[model samples]
Target chain A: MEKKRLYWRICCVAAIILSIITFTPLVIPQGVSKPELGGVPYSLWTSFVITVLLVILTYIGTRVHPGMQNEEEDL
Target chain B: MIFWVWVFGLIYAGLLVFASLRSYKKNRSSEEFMMAGSNIGLTLGVLTFAAALFSTFTFLGMPDFFRINGVAAWIFLAVSDGAMVFLLLWFGYHIRMKVKGMEFRGVAGLISRCYENRLAGYVFFLSSFLFLIPYVGIQIQGIAIFMDAAFPGSFPAWGWSAGIVLIMLIYSEIGGLKAIIFSDAIQGLLLLGVIWIIGWACLSHFGGIGPMFDKIGTVQEDLLSSPGPQGLLTPQFLFASLIAILMIPVTQPQFTTRIVVMKSMKTMQLMAVSLGAFAILVILPTIFIGMYGADLYSEYGRDEFFANAFLYDQPDAVAALAIIGLIAAGLSTTNAQIFALGSELRGLLRGNENSIMTKTKIGIFVFSVIAFFFSIIVIDQLVLLARVSFAGTGIMGPMIILGILSNRKVSPAIIYLSLTGLIIFLLSLGGWIPDMYFDIRLDLILFITLGIAAVISHLTGTKRQLIRPKTKE
Candidate 1:
């Protein structure tokens, strides 16, 4: 149970890091000259990766939850 | 195209009515009507939640945002939405546990009960009303204008708005929450299918994703990066938007109710991930369409741009399907919000179940009428108007967070502070006060300040922790 709780906290902190990077001007400099990866700009690709990371975090959060059977039984 | 549009529209309407009729027999009590049996499974739960999340804003407004704002719009919405799904797991577990074995009236009422103060409910409801009604109005107005643009002379914009609202009211009144969820599922599927289909066409027309962005970058280089030409996606604006969108499940009654009604924590957890996936799939196409607009429709005004990009540029069948998709997008979202407001009122009323249900239905009608009237007044810029609504409702986020996370009796000062913040945000939105303070967005400042204050109060005030999940370290 403690393991699951710690895992949840880590997932949440990772989510916060992703949010900070994506929404702030830190990842992408506030200028016209931007970097690119392949055809997409680095800024756009960075945010997209953050979005995907969030989804993965949710997947992991679900997996690490220890009370899944308990919750279903409660239902 | 007109023939096909009429055919599809009629068929869609028929399905909504059928769903309502199917749910009508079971909706004999307020609980059944309002809660939809509260045993919703994974698939239907996901569909309903996704439908409510992506509305006409995703369809029309997002493309327009992309057209005008550039690639930053993706981060502004899609990234924020992804963050929202993550919050759903932690927040959902806490809120569900908080309200276990109790009948949920609304988030507002639930907060009131938790804080041992009725004013919390009113403050929460007022925030929701001020924000959601305008948000609903924007959805109606966006589709109405697009409908007029798609099928000229078919109906005036107001006429289209009134028609959709009336249809929503009739089915919702008859079938209640179950009908709304069923229709949401249908609408969700249709929205996904049509968006992907159109996205594919746009990509193919431009010769795949790489070549499409390459062309857009050449034509409008500023669009491929942040702060496009208009500088709308500044760091502050995007951060504020992140906070606002993240608060949707926490503060918004429609989503809060959905989370509470899930069959199990497992379903909520899975549904959160599924919603994030749906957000990506649904929003990916709007970027293509918006980039298309930037390429071709640069000189066109809002109405002409949408008409050309969404309708006049498409084949007859696609355009017809686009019309139905827009309507489904608008109706699904508007119904959920207006119904949520009704449920909020039902939660507030101190009466028997039958009487409360009757009054709640009447409240839904009145709210829809107000939204229909506001729809006439709302002009273009669908995404911004919807964002304004989100930021507006978000003023109460701190209060909700404090209520859900802490078990202590809330200080009245916190409630009063939240109310004052809500009024100031409204005034700022209305231009009665300067929208920027110290060169920062008023909403951002307000969100940060209230958030900090809520945290301080929660730490210093009465320390009662009602939700202590099993933790062994």
Candidate 2:
């Protein structure tokens, strides 16, 4: 259970970091849409990837969140 | 098209009536009617949440947003939604645990109990009313305008708005929250189907994604990047938007109620994940439709773009489907918001069960009437108005989160500060005060300041952790 808690914390941190990176110049550099992946604009594609990653992290979160372990007792 | 409209319209109306009748009960408890008996499953939970979150703002507003803004518009909503669901998982668990042994009222009641203050509840309810009613109104107006476009002179816009409010009131009065959820499920599916069909038709205009961007590039090079033509989706705007959207489940009573009423922790957690995927699927197509509009209707007005792209630009059957789908989109959110306000009012009421239910139904009627008036008088960009609504209610996020999550008897200072912040934000919206302070957006500043104050209040407040009541669910 402790191990699952640690993993959930990591997922939380990763999601936060991914969200922070999304607003940075690396992802949303002003007036730049270069390095297109298959012709999708840069900010659009990169942020799209970030969105996918956040959703993936959320799925992982559902499995490892420590509160889920206490449902029989608490919920 | 009119033939198909009658066919689809009758089918939609028949389904709504069926849902209402199925959920109606002669001896229903107030809890059952107001809270759907607190047993929503994963699919229903997800559908209701998605349907409420993505409405006319999405169906019509998004493509229009893209047509005006640029690719960065994706970040403004889709990325924000992605982060929101992740936050939803964590927030949902805490709130669910908080309400496990108690009768879950609306957020207003929950926070009032949490802080031991009626004022907190009133402030929460006030923010919800001030923001959600206008948002609901504009969405109703959106449907009205679209209906007028579809049938040139059959009924005035106000006539359509009145019809919508009547239908909403009838079903909600009959079946209550369960019926709302039932209708939400139908609308959720219909919204997805209609959006994808329209998106596919739009994408086929350019042959594929690459050619689509290629065509847009020739027409408007600025659209391919951040802060497109008009420069609205700047990082600051997008970041502030992310925070506001993230706070939806925390502070918005409609979503907060949805979170608390889920069948189990597992179900709510899974619903968050599913809602994320749903957000992606729903918003992805809006980009295609938006880019299609940007390519073809670049210079058109908002109403013209919607009519041509969603109606005249499609085959008759698809256009008919679009009209029905748009109505479904608008109705679900409208009923959810207006119903939620009534639920908030019920939380604040002090009386017997039957009396409370009676007043609560009256409250719902009054709120719907107010929103109907707003629909007739309110007119603005759907997406921008929606963001304002989100930001407005989101001002209460820190207080509510502290109320729910802090085991300590936190100071009520945050509550009053939240109320003050709400007023300041309102003043800014009224243009009585500048919305920017030293280059930071006022909403962002308010969010950050209240968030910090909540942390301090938690630290300094007295600890009074009570023994956990036995699990009752």
Top candidate, metric TM-score: 2
Candidate 2 error regions (>4 Å): A73-75
lDDT assessment of candidate 1: 0.87
Interface RMSD of each: 3.6, 2.2
Scored against the true structure, residue B95 in model 2 reaches a CA lDDT of: 90
Return the TM-score for each candidate structure.
0.96, 0.99
For each candidate, the alpha-carbon lDDT, in order, equals: 0.87, 0.94
- For B1-473, candidate 1 gives per-residue lDDT tens digits of 98989899899989998999888974377888899978788998999999998999999889889999888888999999999998898888889877777778899889888778999999999999998998899899988888888878978889999999999999998898999999999999999999887878777878877788789878988888788889888888899999999999988899999998888888888999999999999999998888888889987888898888878889998999999999999999999999999999988899677887779888999999999999999775888888888888888989998987876665777799999999998787778999998899899999999999898888777766465445321
Least accurate 10 contiguous residues by lDDT in model 1 chain B:
B464-473
Could you tell me the lDDT of residue B279 within candidate 2?
97
- Every candidate's DockQ is 0.53, 0.66
Tens-place lDDT per residue, model 2, A1-75, is 989989999999999999888889999999998999998999999999999999999999988999887786322
* Docking level of model 2: medium
